[model samples]
Target: MKLLALQGFLLIIAVEMVAVLVHQQHIMLWAAGVAVAVPLAGLRRLLTTGDAGSADGVPIIDEPGAALRQWLSGTEARIRWSESTRADWDRRWRPTLAGRFEVSSGQGRVKDPAAFAATGVMLFGDALWPWVDPGNVAPAGEDGPGPGRAVLEEILRRLEQR
Candidate 1:
C-alpha cells in the first residue's frame, strides 16, 4: 500500500515535470487533477468499506459488531486497538479510514517447547494480541457495560472458570 502510494505520487510529479518542460499548462492541470483524484477515490472507497489489512491488502475482519475469539491452548496472541495505541493501522494501510479497525497477532505454534521456544521468541517479540475495541461512544463510559465490554466480561468469566 505504501509502495503504491509512493508510486502514484511519483507519477504525479513526473506528469507535472513533463508539463512544465513543454509549457503545457492545460495538460499539466489535467495530470495534476488526475493525480489528486485517483488517490482520493481510493481513499473514499477505504472509508466507506472498512477492510484494511497489510498482508491481505484488503479488509480482513469486516463484520459490524464483530468479535474475534481465538482459543490459544498453549500460547496467547497479541492484540492492539486503534483507540488505545493511536497507531492508526487503518490510516497506514488505508488512509481514508485508517483508525477505524483493529489488528492482532495470530495464534502461534506451541506444541513443543524447543520448537515453540524458537517460534515463541519471534512471536513474543512482536506486538500484543486481542486488540479490543476502545468502547468509543459507549453511553456507560469507557469501562461501562457496552457490547464490547460485555464480550470482554464473558471472556474473563470463562477464563476464570477454566
Candidate 2:
C-alpha cells in the first residue's frame, strides 16, 4: 500500500510538472484518477476471478495420482514382506497387523500391550492369531521362510473383511 501510494503520488507530481510546462495543468487530475482507478479495477478483477488456471475459485486434487501412488507403495512393501522370513515378519509386519486390529476394535483408544494382544486374538481368531499376536514381539524361534504371497493375500482379504 505504501509503495502504491508513493507511485500514485509520484505520478501526480510528474503529470503536474509536465502540465505546467505545457500550460495544461488539468492533466494532473487525469493522471491522479488513472493511477487510483486502474489499480482498484485490476484488484477487483483479480479478487473475483481467483486462480488463473481455475477460475471457479477452488483448486482441484489429483485423486487418481494419490490413490495409485499409495497402492503402488503398499504393494511394493508387501512384495518385500512376502519374500522375507519368519523372523522378519516378527520384526516388521507383526506390529503393523497388531496396530490395525487394535484400531479396528470397539474401544477406539490406544491401549496397553495386553489390550493390543487381546484385540488381535479376537479379530483374527485362532487360525491367524499367531501371526499378529502382540505377545509374539520376541524374535521368532526360527528364521524359517515367510508364508509367501498367497498367505499375505489371504491375510489382507481376511483383514479387510474383519
Candidate 3:
C-alpha cells in the first residue's frame, strides 16, 4: 500500500517536472495522461491479484517434513566426525533417532550386532550404520550428499514418501 502511494507521488512529481521543463501544452497533457495511466494500471494489477490460499487458508510446502529435511541436511555439515568421540555420537543420536519418530528398539537383548546394524541401515541407511560399529568412522570430507547427509536424507525421503 505504501509502495503504491510512493510510486504515485513520484509519478506525479515527474509529470510536474516534465510539464515545467517544456512549454508546449500538448506534451504536458500527454505527460499527465501517461502518469495517470501507469498508476491506474498498477492499481488494477494489485486489485486483481488472486489469493494464494486454499479454502482451508493453508499454503503448500508448509509441512513439518520439509523443515525436518532442511534441519537434517544443515546438521550434517557441522558434525566433525572423529575416531575419539564414538561413544558421544552413540549416546546422543541413537535415542534421538529412535525417539524422534517413536519407534521401539525392539524386545530384549540385541544378540546380533550385524542384524541390529542392518536394521539401522535399512531405516537410516549406510551413512549412519557404519558409525555404530566402534571401528568404522566415515572418511573425512565424505560428508556430501552421497554419504553423511545422504544417510539422514534417505530417511526423510522415505518418511515423506508416505
Candidate 4:
C-alpha cells in the first residue's frame, strides 16, 4: 500500500508538472482533480478488495467436517447432561450407548434383539450390560446421579475398541 501510494503520488506530480508545461501556467483544476481522483479511487479499491492469494484470514474449509463437529458437540452435551442427572442417563446416555452397540459378535451389524443383547454383554460385560442394554430404561421416579465420568470414559473406551 505504501509503495502504491508512493507511485500514485509520483503519478499526480508528473501529471501536474505536464499540465503546467503544456497549459503554460494556466492551472486546469479539472485535470488536476482527475489525476487526484484516479489515485484516490485506486487506493480505496485496494483498501476494500481482499487479496486473492492471501492465507491470513480464517479458512472456509470447515464444511467437510461440520457435520462431524456438530455430532461431537451434541454428543458431548448429552454426556454432560446425562452425567448431571439419573433421568438423563436413562433417557439419553444409556439409550445412545445401547444404540451405538448394535453389532454382531463379529463386530458386524445385528438386527435381532437377542443377538444384540448377547453382543452387547460380550463386548461390555455383564456389569455394563444393564447400563447399555437397548431393552432397558430406568423405571419412572428413578432419579439420582448416573455413573459419572470415569464410568462413562471406560464405556467409551470399551466401545471404541470395537
Models 1 onward score TM values of 0.36, 0.47, 0.31, 0.49
- The local distance difference test score of model 1 is 0.43
Poorest 10 consecutive residues by lDDT, candidate 1: 96-105
Q: Give a tens-digit lDDT track for model 2, residues 91-116.
A: 77877776676666654325466666
Candidate 4 — which pairs collide?
none
Model 2 local distance difference test score: 0.68
What C-alpha lDDT values do all the predictions have? 0.43, 0.68, 0.55, 0.74
How are the candidates ranked when ordered by TM-score, highest leading? Answer: 4, 2, 1, 3
**Higher-lDDT candidate of 3 and 4:** 4
lDDT of 3 by residue, 1-162 (tens): 467668987998888787887766667877888888888887787668733445564634468789888898776643532222434444444345544423344511246655655655665556555543333544554443223444445554653453
| lDDT tens digits by residue: candidate 1, 1-162 | 565577778878988998899988878888899987887777677667764675667647556544333333211222222222234322221221112221122222333334433432343222221222222223322342222333334433433342
Indicate whether candidate 1 or candidate 4 has the larger lDDT. Answer: 4
Model 4: per-residue lDDT, tens digit, 63-91? Answer: 78899999999878876975787778887
The Cα error of candidate 2 at residue 33, in Å, is 22
Output candidate 1 Cα RMSD.
20.4
Q: How far is candidate 4 from the true structure (C-alpha RMSD, Å)?
A: 10.9
User: Model 3, stretches more than 4 Å misplaced?
Assistant: 51-162
Predicted model with the maximum TM-score:
4
